[model samples]
Every structure is written in structure tokens, then in C-alpha cells.
Target: MSASYAIADCLTMLGRNLKRLRRYPSLTVMLLAVPIVFLLLFVYVFGETLGAGLGDAGRAGYLRYVLPGIVLMTVASGAQGTAIAVATDLTQGIIARFRTMAIFRPAILTGHVVGAVLQTMLIVVAVVAVAVLIGFRSGASVWEWLAATGLVALTAFAMTWLSVAMGLVSKTVEGASNLPLPLVFLPFLGSGFVPTGSMPTALRWFAEYQPFTPIMETLRGLLLGTAIGHHGAGAVAWCLALSALGYAWARRSFNRERS
Candidate 1:
């Protein structure tokens, strides 16, 4: 297809997936609920104790510190739904029907990726709104806000693509759902809940170097005025690398299934 035609086809497929999302609002609500619950639980229940560890900054300080990580977690949680949706489509023979149609082939997958990213973005926004209501504050400038937004978008895109690959590789919908569970919890292993410095040596090292840590740190710097250091570079590199891997894996698996 020509460039414009391909873009149009992708948008058409995206619209179809979005319509499905609209028709079943329950799925979106369920997917959104997990992060919202976590946000509330952590900010209200755990915030006091956790913030104490950060010194006189207290619960309010912990809220600001953790909000960025929570936002990223929201994206990760939404990605699970993407994997389930893709697996469902595959198991239900929807993909097979698409393969038989004359529409652009790549659009089939593009549609899913785009829809998942958008859904995750909305969930992130809702979670952030809740965080603000509960006293999450940021002194980030306009440029900082824009950069943070870009990083979040990049993270969502990368995670959505990774979920798509997981879904394509899974034998069933349940397996797909289970496969992305690690993504949801990765933030905990990083600097999300508490400082990595407080962990054991090995765990601390791992947490410091993990993909999520750098992303979380970058978000913290952008939103909460924390120092960026090398985290900005690290986040960009991880996102690009993961996105490339996900694209290759998803495409290879998709083509294999079609054949």
C-alpha cells in the first residue's frame, strides 16, 4: 500500500479496536481499577510509614516520590489487557479472518498496538489525576512537563509492543495474561516504593540497573525536580531497545501463525 493508504488502513483498524473497547467498557474499567487501587492504597495506607524512611519529608514527600513510578505502573498494568486482548483475538480466529481479508496486513497489528497505547495513556492520566487529588505535587516547568509526557508515551509504546509479542507467543489467553505480570511488578523492584539504597547489595545493584529504575528516575527528575544524571539517556536507550525487540518478535510470531 502507498504511505497514505497504509496510514488510513491502520487508522481504520484502530477505530475498529477502539469501538470494541467502547462496547465493552467493563474491560477498560477493570484494567483501570488495578492502578487506581494501588495508588490509593499506597498513598493513604503505606505513605506514612514509607515517607518516614525518607526523613522529615514524611508522607507528603513519599507521595511525590512515588507518583511517577505509580504512573508508570499504571501503564504496565494496562499492558496486561493488551496481551489478553490480542490473545483473545487470536484464539477466537479473528486474526485468521483478518489474514483472509484484502486489508493491509501490518495494519492488523498496528491497530492493536495503537489501541493499547491509547488505552494505557488514558489509564495513566486517570491515575495521575487521583494522585493529584491525594496531594501529589510537582514543581516541574513546562519543558519538564513536556519531557515527562514524552517519556511516559515512549514507555507506553514500548510496553504495548512488548505485550503484543507476549500475546502472539502465548498458547492461550490466560497464558498471555500471566506473561505480562512481571511488567506490572517491575516498578516495585526498582525505586518505585522505596529507595534502592535500602536494599541488600545485589538487589540494590539490580534495581539500580533495571529498565524500570532509569525510567522511574527520569520521570522523578522531570516531575519532582530530582536530578536527572544519566537516567535520561538510560531511559531512552531501554525504550528504544525494547521497542525494537518487541516489534521483531511480534512480527515474526504473527507471520509464523499466518503461515
Candidate 2:
């Protein structure tokens, strides 16, 4: 089929999955609450204690500084849910049924990825809103805000693809459930909570050089409307590279399952 037709079919499948997800109202509510809990816990508990130089700014400024990372953590955590849901479909043989339908070979997988992205986007937005209510503000213009949101959505998209691949590969629900933690751990190694300068020499260098630091730096800069950090270019490159790698891997895995 033509690419356009395939995309359309995928979108239709995406809508169906969205409905399926929405049917679990309690799950949806829980998903919404997860970020809120994290936002409160960290903002209240460690916000003041987190950074050395943080002031009236108080926990509030520091909270703004940390919001993007929390947003990312929120996305990372939600993708584990995606992995579990996908694994459920696989273990129950629904994935096999969908494969047989021949609607579009990759459509079902696309649907799941799209839905995960949508779910994470909503989660991110809700978390951001919560941040605002708790005293976050942005002086960014329409375009800057759009750019920041785009980066977040794209970051979530890459993560969702990674989750899809994990779901496909994992034999057990627990395997799928636990897979995301390691990926999430990588960010904490960077400038997410602490300044890279404060870390040990080797760790500071590594943390400053990693993907999440730059991405976080970029988001913080753009959202908070500061300059991209020293490593911003590297971060953008890393994100795009990761997204490409994730897309290719997910496509390969889906094709293998179909075959």
C-alpha cells in the first residue's frame, strides 16, 4: 500500500487503542496521578535541598529548573505501562490476531506507539500544569513554547518505541515491567538534579557529556528561555540519533513478529 494509506490506517488503529486505553478509567486516573505524586514528593521534600545556590527561587525556582527532568521521568515511567500493556496483548495472543488481519503490516505497532506518545504527552502536559500551579512560569513566546513541546513529544516518542521493542522481546510481564528503570536511570547520572560541576571529575565529565544532560539543558533553556547549555548541540544530536535507532529497532522487531 501507499505510505499515505498506511499512515491513515495506522492512525485509525491508533484511535482504537486510545479508546481501549480510555476504557480503563481507573488506569487513566492512576496514570494522571503518578506525575502529580512525583511532582509533590520531590518539589516539597528535596526542592530546597537539591541545589546549593537555589534561593526564593526558593524551592520554586529550583522546581522550575527541575521540572523538565521530572517531565522526562514522568514519560519514562509511563512507557513501562505501555510495555506491560503490549506484553499483555502479546501473551494473550491478541497480537497474533492483529497480525493475521493484514490491515497494514506495521499498523498495529504504529498504533501502539502513537497511543503511547499521546498518553505520555498528556502526562507531560498535566505535570507541567501542576508545575504551574505550584509556581512555575515561562516567559517564552509562542514559537519557543512550541519548540519545547515538540522536543518533549519527540523525546517521549523515542522512549515509547524503546518500550515497544522491550515488550516484544520480553517473555514475562515482570521483564517488561522492569525494563524501563535502567533507561530512566541514565538521566540521573547527568545534570537532571545536580549541576555537572558538583559531581566528581570523571562523573562530571561523563554527566556533562551524556544525552539527557543536553536534552535537559535544552529543555530548561528553551522552556525557561535560557541559552542552550554548553552541550546543547551534542544533546540534540544524541536525541535525534536515539530516535532514529529506536525507530529502526522497533520497525525490525515488529517485522520479525509479523513474519
Candidate 3:
């Protein structure tokens, strides 16, 4: 297929997915509530204790510290919705109907991925807005804010692809919905809520080395003007690796003959 033709087909699929998102607002509301709830709970309930530990201004400091992780969690939490959407399409005979059409085959998957990324980014903006309203201040300049947004979009892209693959392989929508839970909770195991140095040696090791740690650290550096050091490179590497793996896996599964 010509590149333009494939692009057109992808756009069509993207429209379909977006319309579905609008038609069913409950899923988006549920996906969005999780991060906001966590954001509020941590900042209000644990902020004073955690901020004292960091030797910063009480709740205000904790808000800044936790916002980046909450932003990331926003992206990860959206994965469940994406997986469920993909699974629904796969199981509903939509894929078979599309296969018989003249549209580019990959557009079906591409639509879901693009639509998910857009939805996730929108939630990211909402989450950041809520954070700012709740005393989460940032020292990032316009350029730094732009960079942080780019990094977030990249993270969302990688995560949505992985969720697409998960959805493709699942036998049921429930399984697809459950498959991405690990992604949602991964931040807790990282430096998301607290400094990794405070954890036990083993956990600290894992927290420091995991992909989300570097990604969170990079976001902190960009938004709060902390030291990014090697984390910028590490975050980019992890995003690229995950995107490639997910794309390959999703394509393979999507193209396989259905029994």
C-alpha cells in the first residue's frame, strides 16, 4: 500500500477509536480517577511525613516530589483501558470485518495505539493541572515543560503499544484488563513515592535499576530542575526498547490466522 493510503486508513481507524472513547465516558472517568485519587491521598495523607524525610517544605515539597510519578502512573493506568478496547474489537468480529475491507491491515492496530496515546496525553494534562492546583509547583521553563511533555508522550506511546500486544493475545476482555495492572503499580516499587535510598538494600537496588525509576527521575529533573545525569539517556533507551518489543509482538499476534 502507498504511504498516503495507509495514513488515510490509519486516520479512519483512529477516528473510530476516538469515537468509542467519547461514546463510553465511564472508562475514561475510571481510568482518570485512579491517578487523581492516588495523587490526593499521597500528598495530603503522606506528604508531611515524606517531606520531613526529604527535609523540604511539608506538603508542598511532597507534592512536587510525587507529581512526576503520578504523571507516569497516569500513563500506565491508561493501559488497562487500551487493552480492554483492543480486546473488545478483536473478540467482536470487527477485525474480521476490517480484514475483508480494502483498508491497510495495520491501521486497525495503529488506530488503537494512536488513540490511546492521545487519550493518555489528555489525562496527563489534566493530572498536571490538578497537581498545580494542589500546590505542586515546578521550576521548569517553557523549554523544560515542553521536553517533559515530549518524554511523557513517548512513555505513553511505548506503554500503549505494550498494552495493545497484551490485548491481542488475551482470550477474554477481562484478561486484557488485568494484564496491565503491573504497569500501573510499578511506580510504587520504584522511586515514585519515596526515595529509593530509604528502602531496604534489595528493593533499593531494584527501584534504582528499573525502567520506571529512570523515567521518573528524568521527569523530576526536567520539571523540578533536579539532576538528570544519566537518567535522560536511560529513559529514552527504555522507551525505545519497549516500543520495539511491543510493536513486534503486537504485529505478530495480530497477523496470525485466527482459529
Candidate 4:
């Protein structure tokens, strides 16, 4: 297809997925609810205790520290829904039908990625609004805010592609749902909930080197005005590498299944 035609085709498929999302408002609400609940639970329930460990920073400081991590965690949680949706389409033979059509092959995956990214962005905004209501604040300038938004969008795009790969490889919807759980929990292993320095030697090393740590650190810096150091570059690298890997795997698996 020509470039414009390809773009149009992807947009048309994206609209179809979005309509499905609209028809299942309850699913979307549930997907969004988990992160909001976690945000409230951590900020209120665990904030004071966790903040106490930071000495003078206190619970309020902890809120600022953890918001970036929670935002990423929300994206990770939404990835599971993307995986499940893809798996459902496959199991229901929707993808097979699409493959038999005259449409651009990649457009199917592009539609899923675009639709999921948009949905995840909406959820992130809602979570951020809730965070603000509960006293979360950021000192980020307009440029910093734009940069942070771009990072979040990159993260969402990478994770959505990874989720698509997971869905393509899974035998069933339940399996697809289960596969992306690790993405949601990966933040906890990094610097999301607490500083890595406080952990034991091996765990701390792993935490510091993991993908989520740099991304979380970069976000913390952009939003809270903390030092970004090398993390900004690290986060970009990780997102690009993962996106490439996921896209390759997803396309290969999709073609294999269709064949």
C-alpha cells in the first residue's frame, strides 16, 4: 500500500478497536480502577510509613518520589488488557478473517498498538488527576512536562508491542493475561517503591540495572526536578530496544500462526 493508504487503513482498524472498547465500558473501567486503587492505597496507606524512612522528606516527599513509578505501573497494568484483547481476537478467528482480507497486514497490529496507547494514555491522565486530588505535586516546567509525556508515550508503545507479542504466542486469553503480569510487577523490583540503595547488595545491583529503574528515575527527575543523570538516555535506549524486539517477535509469531 502507499504511505497514505497504509495510514488510512491503520486508522480505520484503530476505530474498530476503539468501538469495541466503547461497547465494553465496564472492562475499560475495571482496567483503569486497579491503578487508581493502587495509587490511593500507596499514597494514603503506605505513604507515611514509607516516607518516614526517607528522614526529613516525610510521607509528602514519598508521594513525589513514587508518583512516577506508579504512573509507569499503571501503563504496565494496562498492557495486560492489550494482550488479552489480542488473544481474544485470535481465538475468535478475527485475526484470521483480517488476514484473508485485502487490507495491509501490518495495519492490524498497528491498530491494536495505537488504540491501546490511546486508551492507556487516558488511564494515565485519570490516574494523574487522582494523584493531584490526593496532594501529588510536580515542579516540572513545560519542557520537562512535555519530555515526561513523551517518555510515558514511548513506554506505552513499547509495552503494547510486547503485550501484542505475548498475546500472539499465547494459547488462550487466560494465558495472554497471565503473561504480562510480570510487566506490572517489574517496577517493584526496581526503584519504584523505594530507593535501591536501601536494598541488599545483589538486589540493589539488579534493581539499579533493570529497565524499569532507569525509566522510573528519568520520570522522577523530569516530574520532581530531581537529577536525571544518565537515566534519561538509559530509558530511551531500553524503550527503543524493547520496541524493536517486540515488534519483530509479534510480526513473526503472527505470520507463523496465520500460516
> Which 10-residue span in candidate 3 carries the lowest summed lDDT?
250-259
Clashing residue pairs found in predicted model 4:
none
| lDDT by residue for model 3 (1-259), tens | 9999999999999999999999999999998898999999999999999989998668898999998899889999898899999999989989889999998989999999999999999999999999989877887899999999999999999999999999999989999999999998889999999999999999999999988999999999999998999999999999999999999989889888343
**What clash count goes with each model?**
0, 1, 0, 0
Give the alpha carbon lDDT tens digit for every residue of 109-187 in model 4.
9999999999999999998998888888998999999999999999999999999999999999999999999999989
**What local lDDT does model 2 show for residue 19?**
93
Give TM per candidate: 0.98, 0.91, 0.98, 0.98
lDDT of each: 0.91, 0.80, 0.92, 0.92
The CA lDDT at 59 in model 3 is 89
lDDT of 1: 0.91
Instruction: Estimate, for each residue in 1-259, the C-alpha lDDT of model 1 and write its tens digit.
Output: 6888889989999999999999989889988888888878887898888988898678899889888778888888888999999999999999999899878999999999999999888888888888889888889999999999899999999998999999999999999999999998999999988999999999999999999999999999999887999999999999999999999999999999998
**TM-score for model 3?**
0.98
Q: What are the clashing pairs of model 1?
A: none
Candidate 4 regions with alpha-carbon error over 4 angstroms: none
**True lDDT of residue 221, candidate 3:** 97
Instruction: Indicate the residue-level lDDT of 71 in model 3.
Output: 88
Q: Tell how far residue 66 is off in model 4, in angstroms.
A: 0.9
